[model samples]
Target: MDTTPPPSRPATLTAPRLVERLIQGQATSDGAGVRLTRLLTQDLQRRLDPFLMLDLFGTENPGDYIGGFPDHPHRGFETITYMLQGRMRHRDSAGNEGLLVPGSVQWMTAGRGVIHSEMPEQQEGAMEGFQLWLNLPGRDKMREPWYRDIATAEVPEWQGEGVTARVIAGATHGVQGAVQRDATEPLYLDLHLAPGAVFTQPLPAHHNAFVVVYRGELNVAETLVRTRRMAILANTPGSDGVLLRAGEAGARAILVAGQPLKEPIAQYGPFVMNTQQEIFDAVNDFRAGRLA
Candidate 1:
């Protein structure tokens, strides 16, 4: 959909990673009965280190999202929300507020703690988006809360032969993304490909990666990844990158990769910590009205 011209040089890959397995998101409801699919569950936390959860919410019925997400708390992690359609208003205890429209992104760091609410701004129509949770290291678990709203135009993109890549949080084809994290070195890309198009991305062999196709289908390493499916990439030795080919109907997908922290992960509901004692402290803090 992005008409931006292709970069002069395309990525080169000596060995492309293969799909380890396919995943189907579990149908679930959250945030006041908002229908959604949980792509990354608690069981996969260890496999997808530094990345905790990934939820996809999309619906045309107002009743499904009308209630939206009320005041909720989060700690010891960050939340990156990418709005694909509809408008949602975000308000937090830190006096931060923003309107999330289609193509916009909100990156919030609930380091120490924060209470926030995401409510729909539109009365009727479609609401579609994704929320990805990125874990915080032990050292930064108690850091101050931070938030940012990146407008649609701020997100950098790159176009090639028959594909367009929106770099959300990492470098691709020499184009820097809207947000970058030094701790995790996360790569979040939204790719739109024309029918039969081929796209290549160089990736670090150590990082954990996966691709979720939302529209049409994609072929990776000779594996057919259908729409609404996620393909977990194998971290094979000497693998330098990944090669993706769009199906006949074209495709739209999100490719995410991140360096593993390799640290112990302790989680309880919305609170995440390194140790059980830390989780207890978080619970006590929230109960004592200390968590904001």
Candidate 2:
């Protein structure tokens, strides 16, 4: 069956996007005491400009996630949480509250600042998800904070040719995700591929793209990337996209991309700004009760 969606024809390039670097996500704890895998962070490599941190948290043990993320404050960036298995109850200082179940996404923009808490709704089972941090441009760093919650039904899915991908943002084939923001022009998708399946996606030439493999193995470019690893795509001037193929065991992964800000990044704790003084100001603001 030729069920795969017909790929859009893009301008031919001299080469294909190649793997630039490979990062292995390591286990860590954040929030109140929730254990997770920190995939990318400013401390690890600041070169990934507009994009900040990525954490994969999943476990069957209640104690691992029950502590949850206690009341915490953030500023100067956005936080995205996507659930694959369990439920999370979230409440923010902005009077925003919601329950995120499987296949749900919550995008929180802690522009000036925000205090929020995320706790598990169920005692135990399989709790799993990813939390990503995207940096705000210098101009929008101090804007008002807000949130957008996209339920499973709201996210568009592209299924064909032994592949199913939930488009969380950006366009794939002809489907677009519900979370649309012009600032970053991001693409976030959850993908599942059957054995021997191949999938390819076109991205803007200048955009930064990466794949995080959480299950099975993937042949990215020509390199074998296994579980708990992230493959960074090279920004080849001539290349227009990336390619992937599932290994024998099949594969599950997340693809995320965004236009790079290409600006000075001053980051400290939960704040990210352009300059060190700006970071200091953010800290003072949080302590002075101005960040909310």
Candidate 3:
């Protein structure tokens, strides 16, 4: 595979402009019935450029999950949910309800508005998933609503050395994922590593790149980042490899990159966009039932 970095930064997004970091934080959402660990937000938000949020949820027992997120509203962003071990049931005011099991992903675009509820599917035990909120460019806000349910087989996967990589979106190893996006060409990979593994992937000069190590340690550029940690990358690139390397056994991470929209991002709760007016409009639209 051509793991070649762009010779020069893309005019659209450059190293100095695109954001990256090892952002880390625990979930603190309102009255929680779920176990949500925040990997990026606040300053990380400013650094993500075109991406907004990443939340990891996991539980081996239902009681551990206080409950599940109920009906809520959102606008001007895309919520991409990926399942890892268990299943979750989803229902939207759009009249969509279904079960998502391991390997299933739901990409929902709440452009103008959408109201939905997410609850865990009961089984013997365990439930896990991640939700990535991707910002939509200003022009697409309120454009319309759409949904895509991508199965595990649809994602691209490749392996090398002591590590394995699954591409949920974007191209890697000559294979591409079918997941769709509205802004910033993005890549999402779920990585697993055995003892002492080294991993490398090229980034478009202008795209933002970061890694969230969920289970173990990642030595990025020689900095040790442990579990539940986000590693924001430096804007500089070199042969010493401004990259990430896994440490020890059972290390795993999610690597993401995307071209920066290079636009102001105004976000409130689950809504995201470019201006305060956009946030207001999104709130009004949801309250007025436009989400239906």
Candidate 4:
């Protein structure tokens, strides 16, 4: 049926743009009980479209991080958090809170607005996680607040020669992502490749694909990307799609591909909309405490 989108050669970023990692910066939290950093905010963004923000946090000593994000407010976008290890308990003022273990996924649609919190439940075991922010289209920005909590058993996984992958939010191979919403047809997969392993996945020719390396080293085209680095490949450099491989040491990374929204982006903190007035209205609504 040719349902799959046509694919083209992957494009490489300009010299000023090719990058592999983000440096830690002054820390802040979404609210009183949360922790956030400037991974893809403000000047750090624009590298990826329909995707924003990646936060990494952990509490190894237990006392330092036994606590997690307490109740907070969100609007206009979607939030997806994946647990690599440890247990995370999340609750919202909407009366929804549950624990998420390794390989599990929590997807929230803070359409208009919602208040929530995530905290660590177990003190002994390690606690580590990654959170990503996905923007909503103008038509669906204020639609409604919804959420999806998936257990480790629900998401699909594949293990092959020198590579392993966990499908968190989008499709890959033959299996598709579990969550279905008004997204930009994005694919999110956790990939672990042994040393010197090379792989390539076809992407929609009209879409953009990027890799975010968490551990070890990665090679994007001819660029060398070390741990905590991100590489963006767009416009299809060749008709063959993007190629990814591990460096001397094995590598762990996240691969994301999605169609560009191509819309004007207006974002402020937790809110993202199309126009300035909409942003103003959102601010006033939040300040007035009308968001629910």
Candidate 5:
């Protein structure tokens, strides 16, 4: 007697964030002539709020990255390095040292100031990774400098339908990343999707989010994002998350989101301050041996 088809399951309603813009990273030399692709930087686009720069470095030639990033000073911000392959050794004036191997990360906060160097641990083989800069709040700009070295085993992995997401700096699907800097409340994830896989994750309503594809293609917000391309997603009203699907060969990308500080930024070289005078003070302090 019950011939009626069961009511169709309600389709999961996504918040519907769109790709507002797509940017292709440009090849450039940085850190003593090390080659990399600059993506979502202050010069390339608007200040991505609290995010300053994103660099993807990859090379098989030892000559390209062997030079490495030598002693440099940073103030009023943080630097995050995520390694996919190869090894990098970090040393700072504070007497801290770390070795970042594949699938590892080094997060350093240059609140007041810090001088550090990153050198390649090996001379050959393919090396690849990303470095992101996150701004500190005005109140925290003069705080103590700190660092966190996270090994691959420490990073949590979230598993969903055809997707494996490595949480690096935020919570996703009950998995929380190892690095935690409360000032910016950032979310960094490395995601891998199987062919035809669909993935979705919730984000803070006010956080600014973007996705950078490094391998294969992905359908993000109905837009096809290919390798070496970035998709800046719209923080649309009522949007609480993002949706992405993989192409025939699947996809891999890094998703980063953060709460904006909305403070005035005065940056010069490696220093970021709230005012031009502060920047001057920073530079002067660094030169006068007051910066640490």
Candidate 6:
């Protein structure tokens, strides 16, 4: 893969969105005691429509992530796993298998349903990454299951003055991302910024957006967002985009935005549907061994 940064094409923004709220992730453990932080919890589901959850896990200790995620079932949603460091093997009931390595991404859509597992390929060393749950529209909830593994070299990157952005799911500058979905029109970007550098991204007025800082600190519309914190961008009318400036020490963050489905969201553990009846059906299907 070419390691050179692409040509810069700065984005223009007349009005930048402000941070509506700063969220501190709750320390949590899931998948057989693998430690993680739940940044976008259930309470904020409605506010960030089309986005269900965001979990950040990073640790150098083997005990923190050794067990890994065992067999699990999911329905009516999509999972995007971006690996920053380490290796994880994914296997699904659909017969799809992939290995996620550093800077790789696995996008799996459990449209109707699917059973899967993600286990660490390493017993020691640093493991870091994120798993984002994107809700499927009710109309397409039961379409079909889909999966894809995007290697690190396949993810497109855009370079700016002092920033490098990895476009994972939408267009950034003139570079298109590795994956694109028509319904939600999601935009996912992992940005690395040099000290005191600014990165601007123009966004649709009606789309919902947020940023999660992982390294150092960032300023969004003058609101300081520290490491491990998530900043929800306000949906102020007439706002064109967001402007992110890195703190003196530099910063790395992921910015995600998507068009809201504006549909009723009914969730039950691993199954997300449009109504209680659908949830019950999902449960029944899983119990009867029909959810593959």
Instruction: Please write out the lDDT profile of model 2 over residues 1-292, one tens digit for every residue.
Output: 8895473332233465899989987788987789998889666445565689999998999999999998888988999999999999999998999999999999999998999999999997999999999989889988999899998888898876788889998878788887777888989989999897887888777888889998999998798999989999888887878788899999999999898888888888888889999999988988898766
- Model 4's alpha-carbon lDDT is 0.72
TM-score of each: 0.97, 0.93, 0.86, 0.83, 0.93, 0.97
Per-residue error (Å), model 6, residue 34: 0.6
Query: Model 1 over residues 1-292: C-alpha lDDT tens digits?
Result: 9996545445778899999989999999988989999999999999999899999999999999999999988999999999999999999988899999988999999999999999999999999999999999999999999999999988898888888899999988888998889989999999999999989999999999999999999999799999889899999999999999999999999999999999999999999999999999999998887876
What lDDT would each prediction earn against the true structure? Answer: 0.93, 0.87, 0.74, 0.72, 0.88, 0.95
Quote the positional error of residue 41 for candidate 3 in Å.
1.2
TM accuracy, model 4: 0.83
Q: Residue 33's C-alpha lDDT in candidate 4? A: 41
The pairs that clash in candidate 1 are: none
- Weakest ten-residue segment in model 6 by summed lDDT: 4-13
Runs with alpha carbons beyond 4 Å of true place in candidate 4: 1-37, 181-183, 236-239
Give one digit per residue, the lDDT tens place, for model 6 in 1-292.
Answer: 9998566856889999999999999999999899999999999999999899999999999999999999999999999999999999999887889999999999999999999999999989999999999999998999889988999999999889889999999898888999999999999999999999999999998999999999999999899999999999999999999999999999999999999999999999999999999999999999999986
**Per-residue lDDT for 1-292 in model 4, tens only?**
7795443222342322233443444466544444544355555445567777777655466655655666667878888898888888888877887789988999998988887888777868676667888878778888889999998898887555677778775665566777654458878888888898765666666665667787898887667877665666655433446567799889998887666677777887778888889889988997888874
Over 177-271, each residue of candidate 3 has an lDDT whose tens digit, in order, gives: 66746467888888887767766666756567788787888787567888888777665653222355678655888888887888888888878
Kindly give the stretch of ten consecutive residues in candidate 1 with the minimal lDDT sum.
4-13
Candidate with the greatest lDDT versus the true structure: 6
Kindly list the per-residue Cα lDDT of model 5 for residues 1-292, writing each as its tens digit. 9995442221253685788889998889988999999996777324467898899999899999999999989999999999999999999999999999999999999999999999999999989999999999999999999999999888898777778899999877767888776778899999989898887778766788899999999999799999999899888888868888999999999999988888888889899999999999998999998865
Query: Which of candidates 3 and 4 reaches a greater lDDT?
Result: 3
Candidate 6 or 3, higher TM-score: 6
How many clashes does each candidate structure show, in the order listed? 0, 0, 7, 16, 0, 0
Q: Judged by lDDT relative to the true structure, which candidate is superior, 1 or 2?
A: 1
